[model samples]
Target: MRMRAAILFEQGRPRPYAASRPLQVEEVALEGPGRGEVLIEVAAAGLCHSDLSAIEGIRPRPLPVVIGHEGAGIVRECGQGVTDLRPGDHVVTVFVSSCGTCRYCVRGRPNICPSGFAARAAGTLLSGARRIRRLNGEAVNHGSGLSLFAQYAVVARRAMVRIDPDVPLEDAAIFGCAVMTGAGAVLNTARLEAGEAIAIVGLGGVGMNALFAALAAGAERIVAVDANAEKLGLARQWGATDTFLATEPDCAGKVRAATDGGLDTVIETAGTIRAMELAHAITARGGRTVSAGLPASDAAFSYLHAQLVSDEKSILGSYMGSCVPERDIPRFLGLYRRGRLPVERLKSGFLGLDAINEGFDRLAEGGVLRQILRPNA
Candidate 1:
């Protein structure tokens, strides 16, 4: 079978970059899954900021790569030894794959799986091969192990997370990335205990997810801060107990005031130097701040040495919610099923694969939550 994809031929252009635009939709041959692999006929895929980052150079990668990563679909084929899944099962594709025996994987962190640094960023499978290619006879890079922008994604069986067949593919797709990263930061990494006060800065995809996760985890007070008032309102629906519009100078003071001096946990997902600084200062003594945002090259954070030494404040950088997909993915799906995660709030709109460019526009518009690309539907 031949599939369609949006390939990044080059980089360093403009916001959304040439990578997001001029999407090349062509029929690409569907490669058969090898051993321990599964072939997925993609139904829905989400356009994440990370996808935009790679294309716009906020997050750099090799050229000629296919962009979308968060995808959900049905199992079209399964390779040998894959007993857990078969054709016709619905699943979401997780980009990070673990060797399972590595130190990180054994310790329960597949987000930083040992083999990922090389395999994922190189746009190839763990076995050093690319599964997606052009029908005209050219190779396409599979960013983050799954080239989900294509109509069909060929991925490892480990990357496929089986979900309830009835869950909407669009909702299931966003869970693969944004939901896990945000929710995991709170549930897995922070382990936010009940009655604790929490603040989530930057209320973007990941930040919003953090708020919802905090609510589900039973935090006493959840404060959401953002420069955009529109998103701050969305934060409330996602379970933010308080909303603070971050504008002008000294917004940190407002955050401190709202939290009654300092918060138990501060989650930074805005990816700005200012956001990082605010998060650091607003955290209470003995409190911890978890950063899930991917800051740009020019971003920097400054703090007084005594603040760390005397106050006992700690800062943590989280990747993929410190998650092991095999475990966390299913747990996240469970949250969605029970209505604790509010996965539906994360999505803004849906578009067809040919309308992929419009999805990026919605992302750039600032108020949009998440835009999905529906290929099969």
Candidate 2:
């Protein structure tokens, strides 16, 4: 099948992406799903910072890739040996395609499954196959095992989870990445307790979801930190106890003071070294700091060695929010259905596939939260 899709062939193109045109929408060929895989007609996909990182060269992947990891769709066909899902079933994509026998999968930590890691590094499906091609017959790389920027995708069975048909695909799309990562960091990774003081740095889609999760978890004080005042305002609207602009000269000091001499936990989702530092600075003694962001491959940060030992502080890296998608996605959706999660509040707007480049522009300017794409529109 041939479908219209967004393809990233180069990185670090000058911003005003609409002008420089970083991602081109072209007619591409998609092959049928292989064994243990499924064919999906993409319903909606979200513009996430991780996708932007690839465009900015912060997180490099093989060129000529379809770059979308957060998406939801309907299964159009099933490959051999796939009996659980069938045509017309709604499902959400998971970036990590864990091989059930890998050590990480056996231990209930599939987010870092070794096979999934290698497949992502090589830009192929978990089965080590390239299912997309150019009209000229050149193979196109898949992004995170599920390149969902197109009208359709062929992904490993492990890369998708069936969802309740009643849930809107646009709303469920974000759960694949931002919501899962942010909320999971709070509930699973941090295990935040009631009455615990917490702060979330970076008020993007992921950080905002963390803020929502903190409120749901009954955190005593929740501080929202970001450089954009508009985002800070949105955080307050969403129930943040306090909002701090990261641009403030003494932002970390203010966060500590506001939370009565530092918070019990701080979650950093900005994917920047500076935000990580601020998250550390605002954590109370013996507190844990969790980072859900995917920083550049070469990026690094530093902290005082004395603080780690004397304060007994701990820093933890959270991938996919340390989530087991099959377990967590349903649980999170239950929260959404009960009106506790309110994940829909994160959406800024929707666009067709043709406007994807402009959507990235809005994302780069920090003006939109989550822009949904209607690839079939």
Candidate 3:
């Protein structure tokens, strides 16, 4: 089959993607699903910061890859031995495809499955196969095992979870990454409970979702922090008890004061060392600080070990919100259906494949939330 896809051939392109054109929409050859895989016609895909990281060389990947990890689609065909899902079923893509036999998968933490990491790093399916290629016969790598930026994708069976058809595909698309990571950071990683004071740093799609999850979990105080005032305003609209601009000279002090000393937990979603530092500083004694963001591979942060031991503060790194997609996605969707998790409010708008460069430009410029790409449009 032939389809149009946004392919990133190199990393660290200059900003104003509208000019640099990091991702080129080109006609590519796609293969059918092999064993234990399925073919999906992508309904919608969300533009996430992780994708931007790849473009900026913050997160490097195999070049000439189709870069999209968050998406929802309809199953168009099934590979051999796949009986759990059928053609025409709606499903959401999971960037991490766990091999059930791996130690992490057996322990219920598939987010860090060793095999999954290798597949993503190698830019191939869990089966170690390349299903996309250029018209000139050069093999193209799959990004995060789901290469959903194209009109269609061939992914491992473990890379998708069946979803209710009634749910909006655009809304469900975000659950694949931002919503799951943010909300999971609150509910799973932090184990936030009623009356717990919590703060979320970075008011992007993931941060806002963390706020929404905090409210749903009955958190006592929720402070939203961001460098952008406009994003801070949006946080207030999304039910944040308070908002803080990171640009304030005493932002950490203000956050501590807002929580009447410090917060019980602080979740950092900004993926910056600076934000992680602020998140740790604002956590009260005997509190936990969670980071769900993906910083650059070579990036590092320093913290005072003395304070960590004296204050009994714990720092947890949360990848994919420590989520088990098959279990958490359905649970989160149930919350959405009951109107508890209003992720729909986070949608910035929709874009076609041709406007994908502009979409990244908007993401890089800030103030934009989840921008859905309608590949079939």
Q: For each candidate, what TM-score against the reference?
A: 0.94, 0.99, 0.99
Better of 1 and 3 by TM-score: 3
User: Candidate 1 — worst ten consecutive residues by lDDT sum?
Assistant: 13-22
- Cα lDDT of candidate 1 equals 0.81
Misplaced by over 4 Å in model 2 are none
Model 3 lDDT per residue over 1-377, tens place = 99999999999999889999999999999999999999999999999999999999999899889999999999999999899999999999999999988789999999999998999999999999999999999999999999999999999999999999999898999999988899999999999999988899998899988998999999887888999999998888878888899999999998887677788899999999999999998999999989998899888988888988999989999999999999999999998998888999989999999999999999999979899999999
Model 2 lDDT on a 0 to 1 scale: 0.93
Q: Distance (Å) between predicted and true CA of 145, model 1?
A: 0.4
- lDDT of predicted model 3: 0.93
Off by over 4 Å in 3: none
Clashing pairs in 3: none
Cα lDDT tens digits, model 1, 1-377, are 67777777766555453244645667777678888888898898888888776756777776678878788999989888789898999998887877777888788876788686688778787767777767777788778888888778888877768988889888899888898889989988888998888999888778888888898888989988898999987777767788887884788887787667889799998877888888887899889989988877566787888869899999998888888776887888888899988878777877877777667766766777778888776
